[model samples]
Target: MELIGQGMEGAVYDLGDGRVRKIWFDRRPDDVRPLKAFLDELPPLPFRTPRIHEITADADGQAVSEEDLLTGTALQESGVAEEQALDAFVAVVEALRATVAGPASKALPVLNQPFWREDLSWGEALAALVRRRAAESRHHFRRDVPDFDNLLETLTTRLATIEPDRLSVVHGDICQPNLLMDGPRTAAVLDWGFYSTAGDNTFDAALAAGFFDMYGPDAQRLDNLLLDRFERLGHDRQRMYLYRAAYAITTATIYDADAGDGHYVWCVGNLNRLPR
Candidate 1:
């Protein structure tokens, strides 16, 4: 086996066949079963998506799953022109938006627990989730974002205004790493279940726009460009900003619970800079 990728959730290894294995860092076999079932039932789309073949547990009790190998390089590493890549990114998001959320989509658990409630509206669940995350990492935000409380209040207000939405399949993490490209087209989308939910489709649009290049020198400019594109596609700009802020606050400590990574810095910057 050859190591191919790693993230907070797991490490992926090429099995030297037509398959790859993912050794989950923080999940159980049973925990992944619902996600597998959800993916297995998804309607066909323009590009490929993950398909788990088998699941087991490691000696340490981490879940491990084998999946069909997706063929292509990550979009960021594929040398595709920035313009073309952005178009493909938008295309995939649009495809997902076209898929109306269903029972299976809603039944799959989101990344965080306790905050997610089937009876609650998407906006309410999202607000509760942000509150949960903020409570967990308020110390870091208080230091870096002097207006942490105000920002949280602003986000909560914005979320409450969202009301119930027409549910769509929101990929939740449509970043460069998770998107594989064959030339200018998306070959496959990988790594579901981080923040995956069947909530507002604009949430995916907003997050994907910023996630295109979070750490690059041109990150902010590129983010604005993608946001403009999405706005032109009929997504509301304010709603998008609300979703982006929600993502920043909710995921600030996701990878590093103490909020020490560059993602934390980026999230702080967003918290301070985004209009409240």
Candidate 2:
């Protein structure tokens, strides 16, 4: 088996003959449950996502999942121009959101870890995640972001007071890496690893913007471009910070490899630095 990709929950490997196995390290079934459930509910997207069929075990006894390997170049590794890819990403998100538009709970029946494993209000779920991450990453947060403690305090306090008024189906993690560029204007979405049952739909766009801003060679230009585009869509540009902050904290711990990769560092740098 050749290692194709790795994320917080598990590592995916190519098993030849167009089959891939994603084996979880923590051996947690919660991650796999949501992924399978969410994909089943999506109304025929324009792009391809893996079709998971079975869960078994590897030779060493790790919990392994089998999926039919869909074909396309991953956007993050494709060396495509940022502007072009970003536009495709936004298009895919909009299309997917439209596909699943419905009453909140019926929209996307996916569960996220630590926060939304149950039917909780948005405020309750987000606050749970924030508090958990703040405690776990106190040292990393303090060292990286300016005013980590203050940011933590402020977010934890503010997040608890709010509830989502309108909810749409959301692909909770739509960062650049989850997209695959199949054509100039088309993209294949992969990795429905986490979907929110009740979520703020606008936050998904902001999450993609964060990925673009962090990975771009020039930060300011991309930031301004995204701000203009999202603002035009009537997204509350200011509230993006809150969404971005919650996203950063929950995902920073994934794929850290005990701090080898700089992902956690990158996430921390953007944790609470709202646009000026």
* Highest lDDT against the true fold, candidate: 1
TM-score of each: 0.93, 0.79
Q: Give the TM-score of candidate 2.
A: 0.79
Q: 62-159 in candidate 2: lDDT tens per residue?
A: 67788888767777677778678778767875765565433433433333444454476776677787777667777777777787788877886777
Clashes of each: 0, 0
Look at candidate 1 and tell me the lDDT of residue 112. 50
Candidate 1, residues 108-127: lDDT per residue as tens digits? 76665644466788898888
lDDT of 2 at 225: 77
Query: Which parts of model 2 have CA positions greater than 4 angstroms off?
Result: 1-19, 28-31, 59-61, 77-81, 99-112, 117-119, 143-147, 194-197, 257-261
List per-prediction Cα lDDT, in the order shown: 0.85, 0.68
